[model samples]
Structure formats: C-alpha cells, structure tokens
Target: MTMKKLGFAGVMIVALVGLSLATQAQVKKGKTRPLTTKQMMAGLVKPQCAGLGEALKAAPSDDKAWEELATKAALLNESGYSLMDDGRCPDGVWASACKNLQTASAAVLAKIEAKDYAGAQAEFKGVTASCGECHKAHKK
Candidate 1:
C-alpha cells in the first residue's frame, strides 16, 4: 500500500481505539450510578399503569377501555417479568406483583363484560390497591 494510504489507516485505527476506550469508560461510570427501584418503576412501568387508570375511570363501560387496560396490564407484567429474568429482583416478589396486577386488571375486564358496573368499579379499585401494595413493598 502507498505510504499515504497506510498513514490514513493508522489514524483511523487510533481514532477507533480511542472511541472504544471512551465508550467503555462511560459505561463503567453509568454502572456505578446503580438504578433505584423507584427510578425503574417510574420510568419503565408507571406511565402505562397511569394510563390504564385514566382509561378505566373515563370509560368504565366501554369495551375498548377494558381491552386497553388489559393490554397495559399485560405489558407491565411483562416488564416485571423481564426485571426478574435480569436478576434485578427476587423471582417470587416479581412474580407476585405481576400476577396480582394482572389478576385485578383481568377481573375489571371480566366485570365490564358482564355489564356489572359496580363490580367493575370495585375491581378497578382492587387493581389500584394491588399496584400500591406492590410499590410499597418493592418500589422506592
């Protein structure tokens, strides 16, 4: 290869190596900042749960609302499952929280389907209670 081409290749190699080292340093620094339970729950799970709550309040008798709540609950449960898989929390705690949330949400949907407005409202309260209970225990 020509000297000019070889020199250009050498510069590129040096730049790549520098970039790699910088990235590794940043990753190490980030790891040192350890994620808090509140941070994870608020960032990754709470928005969806809040949305489900809003939808439930506004459209208690609406099929679409019930379906949306079910979908959001499922997503939250999956997120909790993922956290457990990553060893971020004990499997039992994670599973219990997810299952409680899922069950309560599903109960609301079922009550709505049965045209039991009062029952649905009660189930909605149960769902919120489940979320609160889990947060109290596991969230920061």
Candidate 2:
C-alpha cells in the first residue's frame, strides 16, 4: 500500500478501537448503576461505614470477619459511584473528593485482603478525609 494509504488505515483503526472501548465502558457502567444520593447514604455508605467501624473494633481473625471487612470496603467503593453519576457532580470539589473516596476504598480493600490492619487504618483515614472535605465544602 502507499504510505498515505497506510497512515490513513492506521488512524482509522485507532479511532475504531477508541470508540469500541468508550462504548463498552458506557455499557458496563449501565449494568453496575449508580444509586441516588439518599439510597447511597442510607443503603450503602452509612451502613458500610458503620459496619467497617465495628469490624475494626472486633478485629477477629476468623474468615467471616475478614470477609465482612472486604465487603464493607467494596461497598465503600460502590458508594463513591453514587457521587460520580452524570449530573451529580455540580462542581470540581465534589468530583475530586468522590475520586479520592474511590481511591481510598480500593486501598482499604487491598489492605484488608492482605490482613494489613495498620495500612487499612491509614487508608480509612483517607476515606474520612474525603468525606469531611466534601461535607465542609458542600454540605449545609
């Protein structure tokens, strides 16, 4: 093929791949789905946060307790999804804080999975920091 033709084909392939990825991301997000703010707080965040606190206090070595901790961490991650829905982030501050929450949640999950309580404790502070930052800036 001519050099011009080859270059054009390459650009077209890159664009198609990018478009395919974007579409899959949208479809995947639709499946998981963000909850409304109230639903997130009542059903996901509040309960998960409280449960995580209790689990920390207990710190049982049993598999079930650890599993609960992991679940709470995963739910915390999911709760951030509620904040990140389209039209939910009214400003940059909220968007940034929500991103922090998601990052902290993932860190917490990894720490708990490794049975690293100290690390998890530190990461949980990040979660709380994100929460406080948002509330201070946005909440009434």
Candidate 3:
C-alpha cells in the first residue's frame, strides 16, 4: 500500500476505536444501579408527582408548561403501573397505597386534559395523600 493510503487507514482505524470507546463510556455512564422499592418511590416516582403538581399549579397561565406537566403525569402513571404489575410493592398496605395513587393520577390526568383545572387539582391532592398514607403504612 502507498504510505499516504496506509497513514489514512491508520487514522480511520484510530477514529473508529475512539468512537467505540466513547460509546461504551456513554453506556457505562448511563447505567444506573437498580433501585430498591423505596428508592424508586422516592427518587423517581415522588419527583414526577411533584413535577406534576408544580406543572399543574403553573399551567393555569402557561399552556406550554401545562402540556409538559400533563405529559410527565402520564409517564408517572405508566411507572406506577409497572410498579404495581411487577408486584414490587409486596406489602399489602403498600400495594393498596400504590393502587390509590394510580387511581388518583388517572383521574387527575383526565381532568387536566378536559381543562377541568379544579377537578385536576383536587385529584392531585388526593394523589399526594395516597402517597403519604402508603408511607405511613409500609415505610420503615
């Protein structure tokens, strides 16, 4: 092979290797430890709930934020479904609490989409109450 062609090939190989390493590093960085039930509840679920609440509170005047919040609520509802279906909340009391939260979230989302802010706010309060009730019953 010509010297210039060999040099170019070497550069290409180095570029490819660098790209591979970069992707692997990114995957590693993105890897998260599997969350315990409480961690999942506290770290993932509760924040989503709070985001929903904040979004709803602000949505009255900010249509864009309201839509974003509604999306977050929907995502949180999906997460709750996974938690329930996976039997993650094995304690009967905790399971019941999760169930209630799921119900309240659904109701709240429906109200929000219907532009019934009042109803959504009420249901949001219920959702938070359900969380508290579950914690009281099952949290150590």
Candidate 4:
C-alpha cells in the first residue's frame, strides 16, 4: 500500500511539472509575437518622443537633467529601430520614416552629450517631422 501511494504521488508530481513546463512554453511563444504598430507607438515611441520634447523646452541646468535628456533620446532611437523590426515595416515610406527617426534621435543624443541645447533642439525638430510624415502616410 505504501509503494502504491508513493507511485501515485510521483506520477502526480511529474504531471504537474509537465503542465507547468507546457504553460511556460506557451508564454514564451506568445512573447515572440511582435507588438502591434499601435502598441509600439503608444507604449514606447510616443512617450519617448514626448519626453524629448519636454526636455528640449528648456536647457538642462545640471548633469542629471542632461542625463535625462540623453536617456530619452536613446530610447527614441531604439523605438525608431523597433518600428522597423519583426516585419513591422510595411513599405519604403515606413522605412524612410524610421530611418529618419533614428538619425534625428542620434543627432539629439550627440547634442545632449555635448551639452548643446540649441543643437539638440534643432535635431529634435527632425524627430517630430519624421513622425508627422509617417502619420500623414499611414494614420487614419
């Protein structure tokens, strides 16, 4: 009777472990599916761009503020690359816009690193313009 009970307990543990592994596998597969364009824009691009815009409103007075601006620019650059990743880019226009965004954000980051507020502001305009161009082509 003890042997039978142990056998049953062992089988239950194995079954539970298998179930947990299967659940985790499913979740990993789901994560591989890319975010929708809207999701990417709202989750990353928009917020990052907004942060850059707000930061550009005034020159950084200290190292912390400058670092914040640089962080936003880098995030915006990454978001631009993400826009084109995972087969999300639909056409040349989308590609062009994404490239423009990357270039602009890089420029903004460079200016921020140099502590050049005016240059950063100038480059930031290109970032916003790239967004507008893409929206004009695709947004409803």
Candidate 5:
C-alpha cells in the first residue's frame, strides 16, 4: 500500500506505464511515430541497460571500456528521467529512488572521468542494483 512497500523502481514503472495511455496518443519523445511508454521501455531502456552491463564487464585497465561506460551512463541517466518525467514519481520513496538512480548514473560517469576504476565498478553495481530493485517490483 505504501511506496516503500511497493518498491520505488517497480512503483515508478507501474506509474509510468499507467500513464502510457496518455503518452501513446502523443509522438514518442518527439519521434516520427507514436510509441507507448512500454514500447520505449523495451526499445530504448532495455538495450541501453544491457550496454551498461557490458561496460561493467570490461577490464578496469581498458580505457575504451570506461569511455563506453561513461557514454552509456549518460544515456541511461536521461532514460531514467524520461521514465518518470515532470516529477511524476508515485511517492516520496519513488522520487528518492529515481533521484538516486540518476545520481548513481552520474557517479558512473564521474568515476570514469576521473579514471577511478574501482569507484566506477562500484557505481556500476549500484546502478544495476537500482534497476534490479525496480524490475523486481514491476517488470513482467
């Protein structure tokens, strides 16, 4: 019943999906064709998250991997905001979770920027954990 009990990621996703009917009528994030939020989730968010995972698997000494992770983090950060835009979080915990996700993604970027491999790995895990938390609650 409560946001905490509901799981921020899951509740946020459900909230986003609940708004799909409204978004479906409009062009997807200013695309040529219309797309439901669910479609975007499948098309945009999922692959990008996978890319993030791949970046995480890269060797720490791999500069190219860190670069890829930075790029993926930026994209994922935007995707996170896009998932629940206009501050449409379901509740306080949901909002906090969303913010933490965004922040974690940024941390990923920052760690890569500083060439802090260990920090980047930890942040990558943090990002993954947030996604898992939400998916557990909402992903079908």
Candidate 6:
C-alpha cells in the first residue's frame, strides 16, 4: 500500500521507527537520557503550541499579549531545537521537519518583535504547517 493510503497510522509508525533508531544511535554514542522525545513533545511542544495557537487567534493588542505570544513562539522554537539534539534526529525527513519548525517559529517571533500583526499571522501559518508536517510523519 502507498503511504498516502496508510494515512496517519503509517506516518506514526514511521515516526516511531525513526525514534527507535535515534534512541539506539544515542545509546551507541554513550549519551545519558534526560527526557524521552515523547515526554518532550507532550510536556513542552504540546503546551507551547497550544499557547501559541490561542495567542495567534487575534493580533496582540498590547505589550502583554505580544509578550505572551513571543514567549510561546520562543518556546516552540526551543522545542524544535530540542527535537534535533542528542542524536534524536534519525533521518533526513525528521531533520527537515524539525528545521522547518525552528525556522517558522523564529519567523513568528520576529514578527511579534516587530509588532507586525499581519506578518505575524502569515508566519504563524508556517509554524502550524511545520507542526502538521512533522505530525504527518510522526504523530500517532
């Protein structure tokens, strides 16, 4: 069957396999575990994404709102970096997705810093698209 036909489950399976390989590679490198990728995704990426998504729904009308969105975007960017660290990136597709995540989140943060609401909104779409792409290859 084609990957498209396999859908989400197939993508998830691919992600899991990549994760497994990455873990093995890390073990070979004699790295010690701090947190699992799943844990990081659940604890960090999920919440930050949620916050960013909610914040992006409206243009930040004030400094406080902008700060909040900035914080979320920054955290999301960090999550992307974390995903690629410690031999956690097993393959090219995973690496590309993670890089896209970082790039998009950084763009969002820049827009927030510049107080460009429209630009921020456009860039935020890139952020979400990166997440979707990664999930399409990894999330169950």
lDDT of each: 0.62, 0.77, 0.70, 0.82, 0.69, 0.81
Compared with the true structure, the alpha-carbon lDDT of candidate 1 equals: 0.62
Order the candidate numbers by lDDT, best to worst.
Answer: 4, 6, 2, 3, 5, 1
Between 2 and 4, whose TM-score is larger?
4
For 1-140, candidate 3 gives per-residue lDDT tens digits of 65577698788987899877654433222224454565666777878887888766644666775677678678777766656653344457666776787888888889878878788888888788887887686555
lDDT tens per residue, model 2, 31-123: 255644556567778899878867776455888888889999998998777677744665678788889999999999999999888788778
Error of 1 at 60 (Å): 4.9
What are the models' TM-scores?
0.50, 0.71, 0.66, 0.75, 0.63, 0.75
Off by over 4 Å in 5: 1-34, 60-64, 86-88
> Total backbone clashes of model 2?
0
lDDT of 1 by residue, 45-111 (tens): 6787687667656545566665666677566656545444433444355567666766776776677
Over all chains combined, what TM-score does candidate 6 have? 0.75
List clashing residue pairs in candidate 5.
none
lDDT, residue 125, model 3: 84
Per-residue lDDT tens digits of candidate 6, residues 1-140?
A: 88899899998999999978766664233245678766787888889888888877887889998998899999999988878777766567778888999999999999999999889888888878887886786665
Q: RMSD in angstroms, candidate 4?
A: 12.2
Tell me the tens digit of each residue's lDDT in model 5 across 1-140. Answer: 77788898979888998777444433233234354556766887677778777756655567776677777788878877765664334444445556777888889889888988778778877777777766564454
Q: Which candidate gets the maximum lDDT versus the true structure?
A: 4
The Cα RMSD in angstroms, rounded to one decimal, for candidate 2 relative to the true structure is 11.2
Indicate whether candidate 3 or candidate 4 has the larger lDDT.
Answer: 4
